[model samples]
Target: MLRQSFTEQGKRVLKIEQQALIELEQFIDQHFDHACQLMFNCVGRIIVIGMGKSGHIGNKIAATLASTGSPAFFVHPGEASHGDLGMITRDDVVMCISNSGETNEVLSIIPVLKRIGAKMISLTGNPDSTMAKLADVHVCIKVSKEACPLGLAPTASTTATLVMGDAMAVALLEARGFTADDFALSHPGGSLGKRLLLCLRDVMHSDDATPIIDQTQSIKDALIEMSAKGLGMTAVVNQQRQLVGLFTDGDLRRILEQRVDIHSTPISQVMTRSCTTADADMLAAEALNIMEVKRINGLIIVDKHNTPIGALNMQDLLKAGVL
Candidate 1:
């Protein structure tokens, strides 16, 4: 009986929050457009101010905005009054977040922000509230009801605010032509950055470390080169150093099944004539796609002239955090 009650209550909360979001969609009107325009046009940073729970959401919104090509940062409402308002510049935009639009701390610093000539954008649950009346633009984030049974806690309202912030950030991102590479610039320390910014030239084994052998060389010589480089593969090149084919451990296994002599057989005879190759300038993630599509574990990177320049395999990508 207790488990059923818990399940029912959990479902009820979700339904209420879902309804709140549906109604919240209507609030994305001209005011939202005006706010985005203000942010897009501003030459200075976006300073977000909120109190309590709203502050937490504002911080996340600030981060999202900053990462998406809009320069932004969060500041506590109380701290703004304590001289943090100095960060506000004439060209800046201040995004004030308060569900009731009546937070004392947030309201107290408005006149100073106005004196600084910074634009004001108020996100509040009450469109007719004091903060909304004083701001240059007002965005309503009101919800029909809080998910809390007693209707006291800020539940559905906070969710609505968060979604509204995301909408603004994404809208501005599109307006500014923000791209994946631009996003990666701000997030350069994680796996996502590596996938976007890492190139084959940065991770591939090059020069003496690259396994390259003449096509006329014996299969045993190819095996020695492959082992020495530990790339599981060797590039078969002609007299001009132009890549002609690839010799890999997989080819060796296939040849052994046919009772081919590794010591005497020419590598050109047993090498993979049709092989996948990549350019040194290609992104590591792009290389990963090629490897996956071709179902090959190793790749040879060549120059524009088709000369072998580097070699890499799945393991190298894994170690370089490209995988």
Candidate 2:
């Protein structure tokens, strides 16, 4: 009995919410475009206000907008009545949310918001409600029905409101020509930021830590340098310091199985003539992709003349948190 009840309830909720989303599309009218254009033309930041469930969605929308190149912040309607109103400026745009457009706390501040000459955008279910009527631009998130079986919870209404907020943010994001680099600036502490900002030179081995051997050196000499550097590989460079080939522990083992004379055979004979390399200024994440695709563990960083300037291995990428 319990399982059947759950199945029925889940289906009902999904059906209601799906209908709500479909109804929301028609509400994206000229007012929605006006709201985006107002935000795009704002000389200052965006102040988002809401109460209850709408408040939660409003906070997230503000965060998304701020991270995507729109300067935005959320102020609770309750707090705005106290002293948060000081945070709103005449040059800013105010985005207010209330499902019924009649929440007392939100409605109480509409007059002051207008008095300050701030542009107002409303997200509500009722176009004729007081808050909507007072707004400069009203975006209707009206739904056909509530997802709650008892019609008390805010399931469908919240979903429509949230999707509308997302639509607005994305429209503004594209209209402003916001790029990934702009997003990285806002999320500097995240993995995306690290991938774009960190360069090979910032994470590569330097000084004696880099394993380098002359092309004329014997396989035994290359092995000694690789061991001392502890990178499992050595860059084979010419007398001019230009990288000519690479020798790894794997290469050494293959040559040894063939009974090649390690002490007398030149490293250039067994070394890979063509290996993947990166520039010193290349992003570490790009270097990681090259290494992953080539199935190689190390990369030599070279200058314009192909001279070995730096070197990094998979372990270095891991240590730098690029893995």
lDDT of 2 by residue, 102-171 (tens): 9999999989988999999999999999989999999999887898878889999999999999999999
Candidate lDDT values, in order:
0.94, 0.91
Best by TM-score: 1
Candidate 1: which stretches are off by over 4 Å? 1-3
Residue 241 of model 1 has an lDDT of 95
| Count of clashes in candidate 1 | 0
Model 1 per-residue lDDT tens digits across residues 15-89: 999999999999999999999999999999999999999999999999999999999999998888888988889
Give me the overall lDDT of model 2.
0.91
Model 1 TM-score is 0.97
- Tell me model 1's lDDT, rounded to 2 decimals: 0.94
Q: What's model 1's lDDT at 102?
A: 97
